[model samples]
Target chain A: MKAIHHIEKQTGKAFKLKKGAFLTVIDPMGQQVSDMVLFNSHDVNEKLSSGKSLDFEESILLTKGHFLWSNRSNKMVKIIEDTNGRNDFLLAPCSKETFEIMYNYKGYHPSCLENLYTNLKPFGLSMDDIPTAFNIFMNVQFDQKGKLSVLPPTSKGGDYIKFEAQMDLLVALTACSAEDSNGGRFKPIHYIIEE
Target chain B: MKAIHHIEKQTGKAFKLKKGAFLTVIDPMGQQVSDMVLFNSHDVNEKLSSGKSLDFEESILLTKGHFLWSNRSNKMVKIIEDTNGRNDFLLAPCSKETFEIMYNYKGYHPSCLENLYTNLKPFGLSMDDIPTAFNIFMNVQFDQKGKLSVLPPTSKGGDYIKFEAQMDLLVALTACSAEDSNGGRFKPIHYIIEE
Candidate 1:
């Protein structure tokens, strides 16, 4: 087991996960959300695909035993364990525009998209390269009419989900910046990569 | 009215539309789908955004009177008329991987992603630049549990959706190739850009 890494509120981290290694994302403060994106370290173009994962999984509620698939139709990671099962793949990462348009705030705001691109820039990723993220611990519900609503996470402190990487992967993770996503208060998120 | 431009079955086209021009996407034959992507002509970085459109519109089913929004929180186009009210923005443009993974086909296959990148190349758009398209006449249904299913388009011949460009735009259109999306057959799509 490796030491836990902490991602401060409204911030992000980018790292590489070896094939077969376990990566566990922990909502240490509960009610907070984390956004995570993955790419094949070997070929960045073969990145995580929300549409493919949702299509192949056959359910929007992806949990334990379901695989996260890539744009190239390859499995990237498998969820081995889930303490809090609700996550969202339906929405893109929040950005500055999200706050202005949705929240009606006009000033500088930290956003998951900004956090992600800033941290991933070292890996040669750009704003346009970011995709719809796999939002861990974020609860998004949809009605029969397909209207979506973001709700506070149902996780308690120390809740986590564990995944086993299927290939060498570049992963970006963020402590979500949207107030609506984190019950109106941002909190730090923690992760551990087990060798 | 300008002459109708035909996009061959399982193929695509790309062009530019001046601001205030009307672009009507027509399902010339029944039960076909067209995937459309829009980019700001002056700044490709500010392109159509599915999440922002869904968030701002507050509905997954966008029709007449709903505006397609950009990543930068600007309205890119306004849907002024819709004869076939159903459309989908929840899914990405189908790619070769879609056939291999979902349909279990091995050989080469036509795909919206390929058509988009091919036609959009002259506009300086690459494969990675393609975003989740606004799927005209594509009927995608979701269950109460959030599971999604692609159903046959409900459009009849001559059904069309008209959009007034809110900005000078670079547009890509694809006559979709996925069998499930078009109810087991492919058909050409038609468009007219009127000043």
Candidate 2:
């Protein structure tokens, strides 16, 4: 695997990947989360749909061998490898409001929503350019009664997940800014794209 | 209120409004759901955030006297009048996958996600344009244990909800296409923009 890009903590970045390329995200600090969004390279209209992907995989939790499906198009990417299986698809990306409402903290806190909009602007995209994301390494769990909670990631440092692009894709990722429910600090993540 | 535009049943439409204009959705045939999304008129990037709105209103159910807040810009719209108080902000707009997965029916299905995208295209907006919607007139209840279930709308025929725009807004609405969980039929909704 060749390292193509390195995303800093509490920031976002975007890249284009050709079909068959492998994209990997590494949690360098163990407990951080990566909020990832995918778009069709040829047509920005289609995007990775967590709802569709979950339905396609017929599972509540994403795992190796499951396909990530776009809302308009079918399969867009496939998860072929995973070192930490604690990713979450149920939660929306964190925003300024999330910080203000959930934690009572205020004043320009780092947010995945802002990071995504800022990073995707070079591609001429805005906040209205993507759907909800796949929050990799963020541990969120729901009980049988439907109550949900976010938990500290169970991944260790150096853990990662790899996906194979099934089509030309534009990917955006945010090293999440919010502290874990357990008050774990956010950290940087590294990425690799293999030809 | 003078009618400016009328939306047919199971279809979607978009309109632009200056601050203070009132938008009303009428359940003409009753027991139908209208999935609605709102965006900033000057910048499509900012959108109505159900989470933010819920937090601002400090309630789970949207009713008369509540404000609909935007994710970035804060308050966007206000529910000034509501003939039927039953509404939802927790559930996402239904999609083809929702029907296929929940109903075991596999075929083209009318979805709020597709309808919203199709109607907003003329405005150069797409699926990424908005967040989860305000499901007007859709009755969703949660038990003490947090289990949720969709119920037939409590709205009667000709009942409606009216909102006063707090900002210049771009609004998209879909007369929901999925059957009410209780096997209630979907019906058309009439919309009026009062100057």
Candidate 3:
């Protein structure tokens, strides 16, 4: 199958998917991470909720057969297939604040939050509107004490996860920019949307 | 010292604290939970960020001497004391969807999200502005596989946690409406703000 679209390393893309369509996010290069956020096309106020999904799914690691629920209790998408099973919903997408505070960087940096808002701006979503994202191919672990740590993804080249839209949706996806998230190397992300 | 105020069962309150003021949240009844959210008084855009605080503090279990950071990478408050040490920042405040989807309750229900937004409206905040809250005395445990569970709070009656505001702040506190979070019972939350 041919990929209809691809996001370059450290960048993002935004688009709309009709109800019943399928979206496949591909890690074209090994260990790259993609951050994805979804909003109901008919009502932007009803967006993806990490809390709801976690509560309903009863698991922190989401994968094939799990449904991503919205803040309004609606199912936005259902994972139909997942070759790379580890995804993170606990952390918000990396931002400029992430670099400044965590990485100790002093200057402007490309971040998932910036990429998401910029790409979604044409769809009228602002910076504050961004929610905790479904981080694909991202590895996050927690200790018994509930302390979280970001680790390099385990996905290999050509690995992908596919989701079937449960409703008409506006989607934003990022080729994550955080060095820690991508195992210290940048790589492109590929995706295909099919009816 | 007397409690400045109290939040009734399943209710919420909003207040402001000057910089350097200490705010204490008390679990007057053991096993009850309170959710807290903070905003910068001078700039609402710079509000509490779980990711930042978790990153800077290097722990998910925030306790005494830890500082809560904002989205702007500025300190908002420092945990001065913690008698009930387990606080949760991983979950968003329980909302109407939480009831409908998780509990399978069909009718209208009280929720932390509604209480927070209603109480905070006077301060120019809306439902969308609410972020993931800091759940005081909420016992959330995760396993080695990352599966999370909400357990009854380990706090005893009269246990309290105190924070010193690093900057002037607008705060919203809730006597959490979620049944599981509070061990299947509703109870009040007490708080005091001191110079």
lDDT of 3 by residue, A1-195 (tens): 765697999999999999999999999879999999999987787888876787778777899999998876689999999998999887778898888778789898999999999999998888877877999999987787766788999999999999999999999999999999899999999999998
The CA root-mean-square deviation of candidate 1, after full C-alpha superposition on the true structure, stands at: 1.8
Every model's TM-score on chain B: 0.99, 0.95, 0.98
Model 3 vs. true fold: TM:
0.94
Specify the highest-lDDT model's number.
1
Off by over 4 Å in 1: none
TM-score of each: 0.94, 0.73, 0.94
Residue-wise lDDT of candidate 2 within B125-166, one digit each (tens)? 866565678889988766533335778888888999999999
DockQ metric for all predictions? 0.52, 0.14, 0.51
> Lowest summed-lDDT stretch of 10 residues in model 1 chain B?
B51-60
Model 2 complex DockQ against the native? 0.14
Give the lDDT of residue B93 in candidate 3: 87
Model 1, span A1-195: residue lDDT tens: 479999999999999999999999999989999999999998888788776787788777888999998876789999999999999887889999888878889899999999999999999988977888899999988887767788899999999999999999999999999999999999999999996
- The CAPRI category of model 1 is medium
Tens-place lDDT digits, model 2, residues A1-195: 355577887898888989999999988868888889998989877787754565446455786887888865368889999999878775667888788877888688988888988988888787756566888888766554344667888888999999999999999998898885323686787899897
Error of 3 at B118 (Å): 1.5
